[model samples]
Target: MPVSPRIGLVGSQGAYGRWLRRFFEQRMGLQVWGRDPVGDTALSERALLEEVDVLVFCAPIRQTPEVIRHYADIAAGIERGQLWLDITSIKAAPVAAMLSSQAEVVGLHPMSAAPKSATLRGRAMVVCEARLDAWRPWLEAFLAASEADCVRAEAEQHDRVMALVQGMVHASHMVQGAVLRELAPDVGGLDAIRPFASVGYELDMAVMRRMLASNPAIYQDIQFDNPHVAPMLERMSAQLDKLCDLVWRGDNVARDQLREQLLERSRDYAGKQSVAEGSYAFERLGYLLADLREPRFISVFLPLDRPGSLRALLSVFEQRGINLDSIHSSRSADGELLFRIGVSRDGDATALQDAVRAIEAEGIGRVLEASGIA
Candidate 1:
């Protein structure tokens, strides 16, 4: 009979820890040992080297970096071949730490969670092969048994992609929540009702809900620890500023040319590579409208300074059968205003802004910004 691998899990009570414990016992048919003395089970971490064939670090993202190195330091002192693995969201730092630990290491990340007895069907798990020859077969078997699809990625690639997939998405929803809180409309108002909620609003709220339910520490670690996020965020901010200038100056021709230029650049970028295993194109244009959720709408900004401008904007939008989600506004240092209006997909944002410019009535606001709304 084949001997079962003696597995030691450092964390036993947390959500992921419990999920993994059951996964190995029920699915992989492994002789899973809990922390206990005199039963070939490790009662403490110090005794891990005696019985464990594989040590699984199933700690939260924030705790993994510190705990991985701590255990790795201990493992490094031992003079035997032991397999170590960490299943954490952020991969790069832990991979580096494990390399420093001098133990046979592998990086694992389960793409989705079984918050409550969720099966692994159609889910993805990223596997970083630090020691492929020794551990690959067993890892593949484990994943296959669990009904998970295994995808191989480098440590840096995982981190960079996650910075956008998880980090930026979370950040965008956070900004949405902040905007809603600042506005503070009645919870029972029309805005809260089903029919009144546009796709963009619903999608934004859904993202916010997911973010709110997650561990704050994980969000903080993902946002601050990743090194690649800053440059991406800066580029996005600069793009927004450029869009703002185009709207403010009423340069419709320039704006159209710039939009085409941006789209062309996106096409060029997307042509170079594949994402999620060639399943999806990798480009800014395709992903840009993802945040909007309803890509058919064009949003216009109306300065709050114009007393009746909001009503007028809505009237024009309504006449044209445009879907207006919400108006985003902020105050400037010189008492000027910045406004972001969300409208239906068919309505041309540039055309709407041009119409507003033609109105040119006294105290009517200029279009400060406009963009496609998903």
Candidate 2:
């Protein structure tokens, strides 16, 4: 029977590092050791190099290449059966450095952050095999046990995909936040109008918020360190310029042609069924208009501006089985709260009336204008 491989992970103090260490120790019940240059740890570089059958660099994107290079001699001295792997977001440089070592090298990018749930059951993991001779079976079995969807790609291919996937996407969010700050200079300026935001707008803002809240250095490294990102950003800028020019001209015929071309390209890229399911633009305007016409809009005024009031009002609608098609809330000039809510005409009229009365009776809000009844 083959002996289980002893694993050593570098940078075990970071978030991803800690998560990975716990996963290997607690979940897999593997004999795992860790080494952090800055953190107080028992495992030294020499100890890890001499003992572990597999060494994984779990350092930041910027620091990974240096770590691989620093330990290149130690890795080269390892036995043929041992392996060296890196989990950097960018793969090309680190993979190239790891290939210098005599031991088999494999680059693993877990296409996601550390595991938050019970299992990494269906997450995508990109495996770039630099020199996987003796360790191929071992790595494959480990991935299989973890239930990850392992995608095999060349190092160059992985970096190219990440240049767009991580690089361009992050750049777009940063640019958007900068533009928003330029437009709204005050603190909590854009968020102040969040109550009036549409679902799509809210979703976009949520992604922006999440990204902005993360460590800036990490995003900066992912964007700047990727060699293929500069060209991708240039292409993205050209496309943006083309759209800007078309919009500035306000040419309806040209805009319509552009829209059709874009839709066709999107359908080609994502497949017809996926585009149809995901796009609201594909829906006929007449059908949407008909649905809107069948809804009775009820506008209410709530004096309270505090939190949980909105949830309370929504709870009333939920209990009454009033399906709210649209919700628009804003603060009046005199600092009062105004909410315009839409419910289907097929809904119970008595129940809707009761919901409105309950809010007023509870002194939460009053009915300002109840239209669309006739």
Quick one: best TM-score, which candidate?
2
**Ten contiguous residues with the weakest lDDT in model 2:** 282-291
List, residue by residue over 118-175, the lDDT tens digit for candidate 2.
3467689899988977677777777877678889999999999998888988888888
Off by over 4 Å in 2: 185-188, 260-270, 280-374
lDDT of each: 0.66, 0.78
* Cα displacement (Å) at residue 249, model 1: 3.7
For all predictions, the C-alpha RMSD in Å is 17.9, 10.8
Angstrom error at residue 369, model 2:
34
lDDT of 1: 0.66
Instruction: Kindly list the per-residue Cα lDDT of model 1 for residues 1-374, writing each as its tens digit.
Output: 12578777766566677777888887676765454222434365667655677778777777778887887766656714666788888898888877776557789888875434334667788888775556567766777877778889999999888878877777778877786776646665435664566546665776788878877787787777888777767876787677677778777786786777666676667775543334353233234344345443333334454467667756665665555654555444333545555555566666565545543453445654444431
What is the Cα-based lDDT of residue 84 in candidate 2?
82
Q: After TM-score superposition, what is the CA distance of residue 63 in candidate 1 from its true location, in Å?
A: 2.5
